[model samples]
Target: MPEFAPIHLLYLALAIVLEIAANVLMKFSAGFTRKLPAMTAIVCALAAFTALSYAIEGIQLSVAYGIWGGVGLIATAILGITLFGERLRPSGWLGLALILGGVVLLKFS
Candidate 1:
């Protein structure tokens, strides 16, 4: 496997952060009565996807997307567990492990 340039990794990380931010904003906008937040959220989502597309130029789309999604799920789950006091049963842990294992396999395969 080739080592990714630092800049490329930065861009990829930015894309993921933007995507998560957009999703959070979108959820907020749904409960909001004003239009500005909703519109902003839409724009954020568009930008996030655009950034992701740019990152894909330097990385395989399958690898990028699989890592992005898998890591996102894991991170979000951890956040929920720690920040929101959400419970992760043994089955949930098993699922998370499976996802991470799948990602690792994809990275090597």
Candidate 2:
């Protein structure tokens, strides 16, 4: 794997945040029926992809995407529980743990 500059890591983190925000906005957009939130989600998704593209330049593509998706899934799950009153089964928690483990393994690999 290539050495990622601090700025690249920052961009990757921001991309993750933007992606999560886009998901939340897309949910609120109600299948893109609402104009403002839908547009915001589009913008967020575009920005997130752009940042993630930059991230892959410094980090390995597979590793960057693994960590990106894994962390995003965990964060989104937590946010869903808090914001939407969603429930997580024991198995769901275990799945989250597995995702974290996969990310760790990807990092070490």
Best by TM-score: 2
lDDT of 2: 0.91
As for candidate 2, its clashing pairs are none
Could you give me the TM-score of model 1 versus the true structure? 0.75
TM-score of 2: 0.94
Candidate 1, residues 12-100, lDDT tens digits: the string is 78777766666555555766565777777778778767877877788888887887778767876776677558898999999999999
- Candidate 2: which stretches are off by over 4 Å? none
Clashing pairs in 1: none
Quote the lDDT for 100 in model 2: 99
> Each prediction's Cα lDDT score?
0.76, 0.91
Shift of residue 79 alpha carbon in model 2, Å: 0.6
